[model samples]
Target: MSNPYSEQLSRLMAEYRETQRAMVEAQQRLRSLSVTETAPRRVVSVTVGHGGRVEDIKFPTAAYKRMPPTELASALLDAIAAAQRRAVDEAAEVMAPHMPAGVDARALLSGDVEASSFEVPQSGVSDILRDLMSDPGK
Candidate 1:
């Protein structure tokens, strides 16, 4: 006995397979992308791969020699954070066109797409200034 619904189910399954293939390809491309960011005064720099992995880090010779261990550690942390933020921004930008309308790319990259769509949050000037003034350690 042939079921009429069988054909429709097969077609749906084929479509799902194609979509999954495309998603895998997109993830591969994203994994190859890289972003680099440097801290203020060129004291520290970091590079991050598309998979959110840190690829490289560099510190100025003078900065490395002059700063105490704690300060150096703090600077490195700050540089890494800056690089991560830049990497996330880059990922969002690359994924924007590929994403569905109203989808948030950052959220998608963060594995938060299930929770919410992509929406870039705006940072105020005052907020930036306050962060700049605050101690990096704290």
Candidate 2:
């Protein structure tokens, strides 16, 4: 007779394979993602990848000629920041469904979601310790 658990095992295997395939596809999409943003006056455009690496920048030569160097630098930085934000937002969207419940995918990417970073306030800890020391019998 066939094993009773065989059917469940087969179904689970299929689901695992599907999840792997989906992860691969999502990774490819993220790698190929490029967010382009323009400055307030459309004087500069910046393109950044999903990892926030600068991929390209474009500013008209005529505009550059008339713009102050400080303004140009600020515009470049603003455009890059805008593009990075867009990339992070898109990555968060893509990663959310795959992440565990209650996990912030964006925070994890920024190295801010680690469990070790969680801390109880020192004052709270001290209060608890004081209470324990004062009421050892309880």
Candidate 3:
């Protein structure tokens, strides 16, 4: 009889290769999309790209002269968070059309799905690595 284990390993490897290609393409697509969010009163705004990079920030004149420093800071932070959420959503929207059916690109992009869930851990690699490397493993 043929070795079924070999066939299983081959299939697993093929799946892994496909997933890697898909992820790289998704990342590239994300880098191309952009999203922006602004404060409720339009005093602050932030623009972010699909790769979660901040592309720009805008502050209205009134924000600098009328608002206290702490309030201005708070509004900026809120706008950044809003922009990040929009960026993630936009990234998902762009990726949705390209993704395989039933795959949740948003969860993967947002890191809600752990990479470890898909791969095996090698104790040898961890045991021999620096402490800093181990921190990322957790």
- Candidate of highest TM-score: 2
Candidate 3 per-residue lDDT over residues 24-75, each given as its tens digit: 8877876677788888788887888866788899875565568888988998
RMSD of 1: 18.3
* Stretches > 4 Å off in candidate 2: 115-138
Model 1 poorest ten-residue lDDT run: 116-125
Better of 1 and 3 by lDDT: 3
lDDT of 3: 0.73
The TM-score, computed over Cα atoms with residue i paired to residue i, of candidate 3 is 0.59
Which stretches of candidate 1 lie above 4 Å from their native place? 1-25, 111-138
Which model, 1 or 2, shows the larger lDDT?
2
Off by over 4 Å in 3: 1-29, 118-138
Name the better of 1 and 2 by TM-score.
Answer: 2
